[model samples]
Target chain A: MPKSEFSRRKFLGFAGTASGLVVIAGCNKDEVVSPGTLDGVDLGSGDIGILNYAYALEQLEAAFYTQVIMTQFSGISSPEATLLTDIRDHEVAHREFFKTALGDKAIQDLEVDFSSIDFSSRDSVLATAKAFEDLGVSAYNGAGRLIETADYLVLAGKIVSVEARHAALIRDLISPGSFADDTVINSDGLDGSRKPSEVLMIAQPYIKTVINGANLPTY
Target chain B: MNLSNIIDEIEKADGEAFDRVNSRRSVLRNFAGVTGKAALAALPVAFGSLFKKAYAGTRGVQDVFDVLNYALTLEYLEAEFYVQSLLAPGLLSGQLAMSIQTISKHETAHVNFLKAAITAAGGTPVDKPGFDFSGGKGSGDGPFKNAFSDLGLFLAVAQAFEDTGVRAYKGRAAELLGGEAVTTAALQIHSVEARHAAHIRYMRQQLGSGVGNLQPWITGNMSGIDSELVQPSYNGEENTMQASVEITGINGFEISAESASEAFDEPLTPEQVLAIVDGFIV
Candidate 1:
C-alpha cells in the first residue's frame, strides 16, 4: 500500500501492457492463415485495409449485377426485370462509393473474369448472384471486428447491411421462401463472419490484383 | 521516509530494471483502482478530452461482440424465416424448392461464418434460440400462418427489417474499426444486404403484394397507380411514382433528385444501437 508501489503500478499501466490479472489471447496464427494469393488487391495499412477489402467485394457485386442487367434473361417476369435493373444501379453506386472514399488510396480497378458464370441462363445467373450475395454477407460479418476508427466502422456497417439485404434478395429470387433460412443463418441466429485473410482467399480466384495484405493488422 | 532518497536509491541500483519493475507495479495498482482517477486527472487536455467523448458505451470489444451478436441474431431471424417459409404449407411451390435449398445453403454459410468470427474474436458464438415469427404463442394455426399467409405483409415486413438492418450495421460500423479483417468482411456483408432489399421488392411487385412495394432505390418520387392513393398532384406534373418505378409505360425512367444524390446510410451510434438492443436481449 506504499505510495511508491502504487505509482509503480500506475507507471506500468501507462506503458499499455495488460494488467497481471488480465488474460491476453489472440487467434491461432497457424489456424486461420489464408491459403490463396491476394490476387492483386493491396489493402494498405490502417483504414486502407478496410477500404481495399470493401473495394474487392464491390468489384464482385458490380460484375454480377452488370451481367444481370446486360443479359436480361428470357422469360424474365416484369418484376424481375425491374428489380434486376435496380440492383445493377445499386452495385454501380457501391463500386463507385469505395472508389471515391478510398480516393488516391484506392487500388486499381479489379479484373473480374465471370466467364465462369453462364449469364444467358436465369438459373446460372441467379445461382452466381446468390453465391456473391451470400459471400458478401459472410465477408462483412467476419470483418466487423477488424476496424479501428468508429466513423469508418459506421460507414462499413451501413454498407454491409446493404449487402445482407442483397443476400436475402438473392436467396428469395432463387427460392421465394428462403430469405433468412438455416442455410444462411446458423443455430445461433447470427449471420456468418470471416476474417479478412479468409475472405481474400475466397475472393482471390475472382480478382486479378494479387493482394498483399501483409501490412494489414489483425485484432 | 524521504521520497527523493528512495527514488535515488532505486535509480542507482538498476535504473532500467527498476523502471520496468516500477512500471509493472504501477499497472497492478491501477488494476486495483487505487491510482486510476488521479492518473487520469493528470492527463493532458487532449487525452482527458477522450474521456468526455461519446462512447456509445459499447463495452469496447465486448460491446463490439454484442453488435456482432445482434447482427447474428438478425441473420438467424432472416435465415429461419426463409427456411421455414420454404417448407411452410401453401407458401412456396414444390417447383421452387431447389432454388430455396441453394439459398438455404448460403444462409447456413452466413451463420457459420459469424460463428467463426465471434469465436475468432474470443467471444462465445451465440447458440440459435427459438424465434417467434408470429407476435404471440398459441394462436391456432400459429406463427407460420401469420408470417406466411399474406405475401404482401410478408414482403413489407421483410423490407422494413432489412432496411433497419442495413442502418443498424452502419450504426455499429465504428465499433469494429479497431480490427481490419473483421471490418472488410462486414462491408462485404453490408453490400449483399442492400441487394437483398432490392430483390425482395421486386418479388413483392411480381406477386402483386402492394403498389408502393416498388424498389426504394429505383424510386425517387413518381406517380403510378399507387401514387393515386395519395393526394393528387403529389409532385407538380412529374409524378413521384414515375421516378419510383422503371417501366416502359413511364416514358423511360427520369432520374429523381434523390437518385442523383450521394446517399450514405445514417449512422446509429453504438450507444443508441446498444440501448435498443438491450431491450431485446433478455
Candidate 2:
C-alpha cells in the first residue's frame, strides 16, 4: 500500500520548490523549467524517487509488450509467441506492483512513443525489446544504492532479474547464444550499470515525460 | 563513507548507538570522521519469508573485500565449467556450441573483473579452484561420465551453475553495501546468469524431453533434476510469499501460486551455494 499522498504533479512541483533538487533535462523539445514548477516528471528524493524511477521503466515495458502482442510479429514462431506473452504478463505484474506500492506517491502514467519501432517485423520488435529489457536491468542495478529501504531494494532485485531474463530470451530469439554478449556486458565479466541519469538519457526518446533524478542518493 | 564494521553493528542498533556515542563512540566516531560518509551504504532487505528464514541468522561477509572474493571464486567455477565444456571434443556444435562460447566469455570477464577489483582494493584475489565436473575428486572422471558426451547432462550442469549463481548473488547483494558499485555490478551479473538459466531451460524444452512447456524459472517440480551435486541450488526456491504478502490472487487477477513464486527468484546463502559448488570442486 502507498504510504502517503504523493501525486505526480505535486511531487514535480515539490521538486522545483524543494531547494532546486532536480535538474530536468532531455525532453523531446527544448522545454525550459518554469520559475517554480518542474517542466517534466521529477522523481522525488530517497526511496520514493527510486520506486518512481522503476515504475516508469515497467510501464514502458508493459506498454511495449501490449503492442507486441496486439500485432504478433509477422509469422512469429510458437515458442517466441509464448515467451513474449509470458514476458508481457510479467511486465504487467511488475507495473501493477510498483503502482500499488507507491500509491499516491507514484508518478503519473508515463506516455511512451513506440513510433520508431517496426512492430510487424520480428527483427525490429525483438531488437527494441532487447534494448528496453537491457536498459531496465541496468537501471535497477544502477539505482540500487539510491534506495534507502532494504525491502525496497529486495523488491528491485526481484523485478530486475526478470527483466534480465526477458532480455536474454529476446536476445536468443534474435541470435541464439547472444544473450550475454559483449555489447552490454563489459570485458571484465562485470555487468556495467549506468547511473540513473545515464540510463534516462538513452530511454528519453521513448518516454514522453522527462525524469529528474539529480537528487537521488548515489552512495 | 565506508564506516568500519564496528560502527555498522553499533549504528544498526539505533538507541544503543546513541548510548555508545554518549559513552565512547570516539573510536567509531573518529573512524566516521576519517571516512566522512555514512558507515553503511545500501541497506540490506530485512523482510520477506526467505529473509526471515535464510538471511536473519546467517553470517554476512566481513567486508567488501571478502564479498568480492566470494563472488570471484564462484565466477572462476562458472568460467572454468564453460571452458571445459567448450574444450570437449564431441559435446556440442553449431548454435548450441556458439551459445556456450559466448557465455564462456561473460564468465571469464566476471572472473577477470573480480580479480582486478580485489587486487585494486588491496585484497588478495582468491585463486581459481580446480573443478571435476563428474562429482569425483582426483580421479579425472566424475559421476557425469557424459559431461562432454551428453548434451542433456551438460545443460543440466549449466542450469545448476547459472541458477545457483542467480540466487547466490542475491543472497549477498545487499550485504555488500559497503561498496555500492560492486553490489550493483554483482546485480547486473546476477541477471545475466538468470538469462543463461532461462536459455538453458529453453534449449531443454526445444529438445522435447517432456519439459517442453518449461518456463524460464523453477516451477517446483524437481523430477528430472537428480544430480545431488546441483540439487541444493533449488533450496528455498519454493517460497510463495514476498515481503510477507501472498503473491497469488491479488487485485482479482488470479495468478498461479507457482508463477507467483517463479516471478521473483529467492536467494541462497554462500554456505548453501558452496555446499553444492564444493561437490564439483576437487
Candidate 3:
C-alpha cells in the first residue's frame, strides 16, 4: 500500500482502540505504561498538554528540515543551502529544548508522513516549510492565553517570534516582497491565530501518530 | 492622595470608574468563594475589567493602557518613517520599494488599531511624537542623516526599528496574559513585527553592500550592521539561557551558541526599548 494510505489506516486503527487502551492503562495502577503502549498519545492536561502540543509540532518541523538537508532540493544555491541548514539546526534545537524541559512528560517521538512532499523540488520544499512555520506561529499565539505560568508564556513568546521570522523568510524565498502578505497578515496588520484543535486538524495528514488534544485548555 | 480623593480623581477622569470597579470587585468576591472550571471561565471578564480600572489611572499599576500607549508610540515612529521614506525622491525602487510599502501599511494599521483599542478602553491615546528618522533627536542631522536619500542607511535603520519593535512587544506580553482578547491581539501583532524584522534583514542580506553577513534571524547579539548606532537593538540578544536552562550543548545535540540564540528571540525591557527609540523621537 502507498505510504499515505498506510498511515491513514494506522491512524484509524489507533482511533478505534483509543478508549480500550485508556481503560487498560487505568486498571494497571502500578504499571508505568509507556507512551508507545497507548493507541494514541494524550497531550495530558493544562500546561504539560500545551508543551507537548508544541513539542509535537517541533518534532514534525525538525524531521522535515532534516530530510530537506539530507536530500537537498534540485538546483539549490549555496546561500539557500546555508540558510535552510540554519533553519534545520534551529528546529532541532527547539525540538530538543522542549523535550528536555518536559522530561518525563514529553510525548514519544512522533512518526511523520511526508509522502506528499517532493523534497527534491524547491517549490515543494519551500511551500511546505512556509505552511509549517506559519502554523507554528499561529499555534503559539493562540496558546499564549491558555498558559497559566508567566514563565511558560514568556517562553512561548520567545519562540513564537522566531517562528514568525522563519515564516517571513520562507515567504520571501517564494516571492521577493511578499513576506507580510495579506494571506497570513490581516488588514488590521495582525498575524493569524489558530486554536489547537484547528491547527491539529490541518496538521493531521502530515503526522502519522494519533494526537489526542482533547485535554488541552481552551478559552 | 487619600483613598477617597484618589477615587474622586479617577471618577472625574472616568465617570464609569466606580461602576466598573464595583462590578469587578463583585466578580472577584464571587470567584473567591468558587473554584474549578466556573471560576476559570470568568477569568477573562475579571481580567478585562481589571485592565479597564488600570486604564482609569489606577496608581501603582502598570496597566494595559500603558503598554498599548507604549506600542502606539513605537508604531507612530515606524509608520512615519515609512511614510517619509516613500515620499523621498530617488530612493526605494523595484522590489525594495514594494516591500517597504507593504511594511508601511502594516505599521499604519497598527497605529490605528492601538489608538482605537486605547479609546475603547476609556483611555486617551497618546499623541504621535515627531520623529527625525536621521537619529537627530530633533537636530535634523544625526548619524543617519541620509536615511531617506541613501537606501543602504535607510534599510539599516529600518531593520533596527523592526527588530526593536519585536523585542518590545515580547517584553510586555505577560502584562496582558489574563486579558485573553488583548493578549491574543498583541501576540498577533507581535508575530507580524517579527515578520517585518525578518524581511528587513533579508533585504539587507540581499544588499550586502555595507551590511555585514546578515541572516533573516539575529545571530549572537551581533548587529548585522557594522555601525555602533544600531548596536543597542541587538544587545542582550546573545542570551542562550531560557527559563534558567542553558540551551547551548543541552541534550548533547551539538547545538551551537548562534543556533541556540537564534532559536529564541530575547525580550527588551520597556526602558531599554525607549532608550533605543528616543534617539529618533524629536
Candidate 4:
C-alpha cells in the first residue's frame, strides 16, 4: 500500500487484462509481463481457447437477455418485446451450441456481473446489447484466422453473421439509419476486428470468471 | 450411365483429384478430375448434382492473389452501383439519403482498399465491369424507371446486393485462411457487408410496404419476396441445416424452423451471385 510502489497487478485488473494474465504466467519471457484481472479463469489453448472465448460472451449475452425479459422495462412495446424474445432465443441457442460443441473442452460457466447495468432502463439494456453484439462480430472476425480447421472457421461465420444482424437491428432501434455508422467501420470499409485478448479485456468487468487463454494459438 | 462403373473408374483413376472423402467430397473430387474429353467416356451423367455442390464448396487452398482479385471484382460492382445511386437527382432523401450516402462512401473505400490489396499482393487487379443496374429489365433509361423513384424497390435491390456480398465473402473465407492477415481483412469486409444488408432490410421495413417478416437477418424464407430476379441471390438460404445436422433434429434443443434458419446465414457461390447481378450489367 506504499505510495512509491507501482501496483502492476491492480493496473492490469482495472485494465481488464484477465485472459492476457494466463499468457504472462505461462511464458516466463525475461521482460516484465503484466497479468490480467486477479483470479481470472483459463480459456484453454488451441481451438478450445477460441471456443471458450465465444462461449464466455454468449453466456453474458444470454444472461443479459434473460434479465431483460424478466424485468420488463417500462414503455417496452409489443414489437420490441417480440423482437427481443427472438434475439434472446437465438442467443441462448448460440450459447448452448458452443457449449455443446466444446463439451469437455469448454470452460466452466462464468459468473456475470451486471450490477452496473440498469435492467429496468430500456435504453441502458439496448446500449449494452448493441455493444455486446458489435464486439462479438469483431471478435469472431479477428479470431477467424486463428482457427486451424475449415469446419470451425465456417461454423464461426454462421454465428458472427447473426451477431452482425443483431448489432444492426439494435443500432437502428437506438437511432434510425445508424446500423453501419463510422464507429465500427474503419476508413478501409472494413468492420471492426478485435483480438481475443482485446475482446476479453473489454468484456472483463461483466465476467467474474478468470479465463486463462495464454496457450491459445496465434496465427 | 452406370453409377457402379463411375465408382470403379474413380477407384482406379488418379491424378489431381485432391483429398478423398466419403460420399459428398469424394463424389465432388472425382467429378472434378473428370473435367475433359479423356474422362468423358468413363462417365456419361458427369455427376451434375454433385458438381454443383462441389463448385459451391470451399476454394480449398487457393493462392492469395486469386482471392484478392476475386474480391476486387465484387467491390468494384458494389462501389459503382452505390456511386450511380448517389449521382441520381432526388433519388434519396432524409434518413434514407444519409444512410445510403455513408454506405456509398464505405463501398468506395472498399474498392480502393481491395485494389491496393491486390496490387500489394503482386496480382493484377481486375478491370471494373460496366454495370446496367436496371437488371436489364429494360434499356438503360436512367434508374428513375428502374428503382430510384420508389424507395421500396430501391431498398429491395440494395438488400439483394448487400446480401450477395455477405455470402460471396463467406464462400471464399476458407481460402484466405492460409494467410492470417489477409483472412482478417476479408472477414472485416464480410462483417461490414452483413451490417449493410441489415441496414437495407431495416430501411425496407421503414418504407412500410407491409412486407411481412422482413428483418436484418436472412430467414432464408425469402419466398415472400416473390421475385424471380432475386431468387438466385437467395438460393440455398432456406436451408435449416448447419454442420450437417437438421436444426430441429438436435437432441434436447427445440428451435422453430424459422428461428433455426434465421440463426445462420449460408454462403452463396460466386457464379450464383454473378447470375443475380449479371442481368444488371449491360
Number of the top candidate by TM-score? 3
lDDT of 3 by residue, A1-219 (tens): 443344334333333333322312122257454454434788888999999999999999999999999999999999999999999988998899999899999999999878877788888788788888988898898878788777888899999999999999999999988788987787678887777765676676777887777677875
Evaluated on the second chain alone, the candidates' TM-scores are 0.56, 0.75, 0.80, 0.73
| DockQ, all models | 0.17, 0.28, 0.43, 0.31
Candidate 3: stretches off by over 4 Å: A1-39, B1-62
Tens digits of per-residue lDDT for model 2, A1-219? 121122222222332233233354332245554354455687777788878888888888889998998999789988788788778767776777777777899989888867667788777787778778877877887777566566777678777787787777788788877777777665445454656765665666666666666555554
Candidate 1 stretches greater than 4 Å from native: A1-41, B1-162, B165-169, B172-203, B216-282
Best by lDDT, which number?
3
Per-candidate TM vs. native?
0.54, 0.77, 0.83, 0.80
Query: lDDT, candidate 4, residue A212?
Result: 58
Model number with the top DockQ: 3
lDDT of 1 by residue, B1-282 (tens): 222232233223222211122232322222112113344355443311121132334345455456556667657766786787676777565534554454455555556666555554345555564555553332334333365665555555455444445555666666555434345445545554555555555556666734554543423333222323222212221212211332222223333334332123444443444332221222
Question: Each candidate: RMSD to true structure?
Answer: 18.6, 11.3, 8.3, 12.5
lDDT scores in order = 0.51, 0.66, 0.78, 0.68
A-chain TM-score of every model: 0.80, 0.82, 0.83, 0.84
Q: Tens digits of per-residue lDDT for model 3 on B1-282?
A: 222232233334433322333334333332221112344455555544544553344232336666777788789999999999999998988888889999999999889877666555555566776777778778898899999998888888899999999999988877776655567778888999999999999988888776667899999998778698788899999999887778898788778999999999999987788778766876
Scored by lDDT, model 3 comes in at 0.78
> Candidate 3, what DockQ?
0.43
Q: How far is B91's C-alpha from truth in model 2 (Å)?
A: 1.3
List fnat per candidate, in order.
0.39, 0.46, 0.75, 0.57
